[model samples]
Each structure stands twice: as C-alpha cells, then as structure tokens.
Target: MAASLLYPFVLLAGALQALGNSMNAQLRVALTNPWLAALVSFLLIVFVFVAMAAVRPQPFPEKASVAAMPWWAPLGGIAGAVAVFMGLLFVDEIGAGPFNGLLITANLLASLAIDHFGWLGMKPKRLGPMRAGGAALMVAGIVLIARS
Candidate 1:
C-alpha cells in the first residue's frame, strides 16, 4: 500500500490508541492492581497476535535470518509494554488530552532526533526548517492542551 493510502489508517489507529488508553486506565481501577491489569491487557494482545500469525501461516525464519537480527530487536515489545503500563498508571490522574499531548510531543521529538541522527539503522533525514517549525507547533499545542 502507498504511504498516502495509509494515512487514514494511521489516523484511525491514533484515535483507537486514545480510546485504548482510557479503557486501560479503567481496567487498572477495576482490577485494583497495575501489574495485573497490564498482564491481562498484554495477554490479550499476545493471544490476538498469536492467532493472527497462526492464521497467516507465514514461513518460519531460517536460523541464519534469526541469527542476523539485532539483539535489541526484541526490545521493541518491551518498550511498547512500558508505554501501555504508563497509560494504565497515569491516564486517570491526568486527563486524556494532556497525557496524549505530552506523549505525542515526546514521541515527535524523539522521532525527529532519530531521523536527524540516523539512529537504529534508519536513513538520516536532516531536520530542516519545516520539520523544526512543525515540532515547535506541536510543542505549542501540547502546552495549550496541558494548560487546559
């Protein structure tokens, strides 16, 4: 699929993420334990992904392919779990708008730095004026959200 066509899906995914964060916060309260809530939430994700992989029936990676992967590659899932746990722990205390705004601002800044430095094997994209301006605007937006 072309990148243009994926934009709507990305927008939808963002909306769903906001919803998920709120839901997860409630789940934490209902379960009365942060660890248990996170475990149950991630277990559902694991089961769904496992079911999807089983249905898709992709070819298994060869030993050489697996061996060639970076050791940190698997850390992506751990990083995601940290994000989910943050949502479960903090979203209720801080409203969704402020929480998401700060989260997105941090994500944008980190992404800009990653692109600028070509970190993690990504091709370097210079942080030109336009990108910097966009980031400034995002910061302003976050400030407004946080203040409100």
Candidate 2:
C-alpha cells in the first residue's frame, strides 16, 4: 500500500513530458521542417546515448543472440519522432499551453482506451463509470482551453 503512494510519479512524468515538448518547440523554431528537426533530435539523442555508454559501458548481446524484430519496430520510432515534431509546429502556431493541454487530454483518452481493451498485451482494466466521467471532463477542459 505504501508503494502505491508513488502516484506522484504520474505528475513527474507529465512534468517531464511538458519540459520535453518545450525543448521540441524551441528546436522546431530552429529547423525548417519537422523531418529535419526530428533527424537532428534523433542524432542528438544517439550522441547522448553514446556519451553515456562511454562513461559506463554496458554489455552488448552477441550478434547471434539478437533476433530480427518486425520492421514496424523501427518505423514506430520514426513515426513517433515525426509526429512529435509536427505536433510541436502545429501547436506553436496556436500556443504551447493550449497545445499541451489538448495533447495531454488526447494521451489520457488513448491510455484509457488501451487500459480498457488491454491492447498490446497490457492487462485490461475495468473502465467504470467514474473513469469514463473523468475522461469526459478532461476532454471538455481541453476543448475549453483550445477555444480560449
């Protein structure tokens, strides 16, 4: 029960996401296109990973131990990166707070659906009336913020 008190982790995650979005918005302003922005961002992330690895090298699996994953695996990363950069640009045209509020609302709804259906092998959660009502309120808030 005490472990469950880590619920604040959700708030921390949201804060980190908001911070990441702000950085992405800044990068979007510097780049000409979303694709270019994503590319640069990806390169920077890879560079950071390499630098960390240099400081603390981790064991790598043998080539034989690696199995080919579905092509969709890599495509998913590419798609996510492209979508984030594009979303940043779209939201920047409006406003960061509004865009983030709507985006967070969308994420909440999507997570609810995923939890309800247990998509991708996730454990399904019962979506009671309370959860549904809360989701509805979130959507309403997003709409109000967007319209403001």
Candidate 3:
C-alpha cells in the first residue's frame, strides 16, 4: 500500500522534471547560449531557495558545523551546474527519453560503485547477483530506449 502511494510521487517528480527540461531547452534554443540558459535556471533556483528561507526562517549553520563537513561537499554545485548545462545543451536536440536514459545509466553505475565502495562517507552496500542483474536490466532498457 505504501509503495503504491509513493509511486505516484515518483511519477510526478519525473513529470515535473520533464516540464523543467523542456522549458530550459526552449530557453536555451531562444538564447542560443547554453551557459546563459543554465545561468537563468540556477538563478531561478536561487530565487526559490531565498523565498523558502524567508518563509521558513531556518537558522544558519554554525561555523563548526560547516567546518565538520568534508571539503568535497562544497563542490556539489559544480555537478548541479553541469546537469543544468547539459540539459540546456542537449535535451531539445536529443529528446528527453534518451537523455534521461543515458543520465540514468550513468547515475546507476556511479551509485552502485559509490555504494559498493562506500565512497564519500556513504554506507557500504556490497554488490551481489541481484544487484548486478538489476543494473544490467536498466542498461538494457536504456539501450532499447535509445534505439527507439
């Protein structure tokens, strides 16, 4: 029952992502600049976060709390920027299905490696036959989607 209820939210997330991608892709096409499109996308995120912070008024993290985090934690923005840039650059030309498929493939492989090796302080999850099979199936599905 819980899984079924949660599934719609997952679907909704994908739907929302698709809409965002399409909007950004159009913006990039109009601007003729992926970098500008990405900038606008990120600026919107900043706006929303700023509004959210105002509405909720959460306390700022203490100096010690920031100091305790790994140095690499601060570099996550680069990854987010790359995602926005790539989506702006390619989503319209390549289409969402193939882009998502390739993204998912890369994400799954990276996640599996991260989990298996406990990289960046994640809990270690040893890979097994089922995990291997699932990853393989995902790759196969992506291949089929790309071929289509």
Model 3, span 1-148: residue lDDT tens? 7689899898898778767777889999888888887888889999999999999998889999999999899888898677667878888788899987787788898999999999989999999899989999999999999898
After TM-score superposition, the amount by which residue 123's alpha carbon in candidate 3 deviates from its true location, in angstroms, is 0.7
Model 2 segments beyond 4 Å from truth?
Answer: 1-6, 54-76
Task: Report the Cα lDDT for candidate 2.
Answer: 0.78
Model 2, C-alpha of 148: deviation from truth (Å): 1.0
In model 3, the clashing pairs are none
Winning candidate number (lDDT): 1
Residue 39 in candidate 1, Cα distance off native in Å: 0.4
Q: Would you estimate the TM-scores of all the predictions? A: 0.97, 0.76, 0.89
**Candidates 1 and 2 compared by lDDT, better number:** 1
**Which residue pairs come into collision in candidate 1?**
none
Per lDDT, what order, best first? 1, 3, 2
**lDDT, candidate 1, 24-104, per-residue tens:** 999999999999999999999999999999989898889998999988888988987887899999999999999888888
Greater-lDDT candidate between 2 and 3: 3
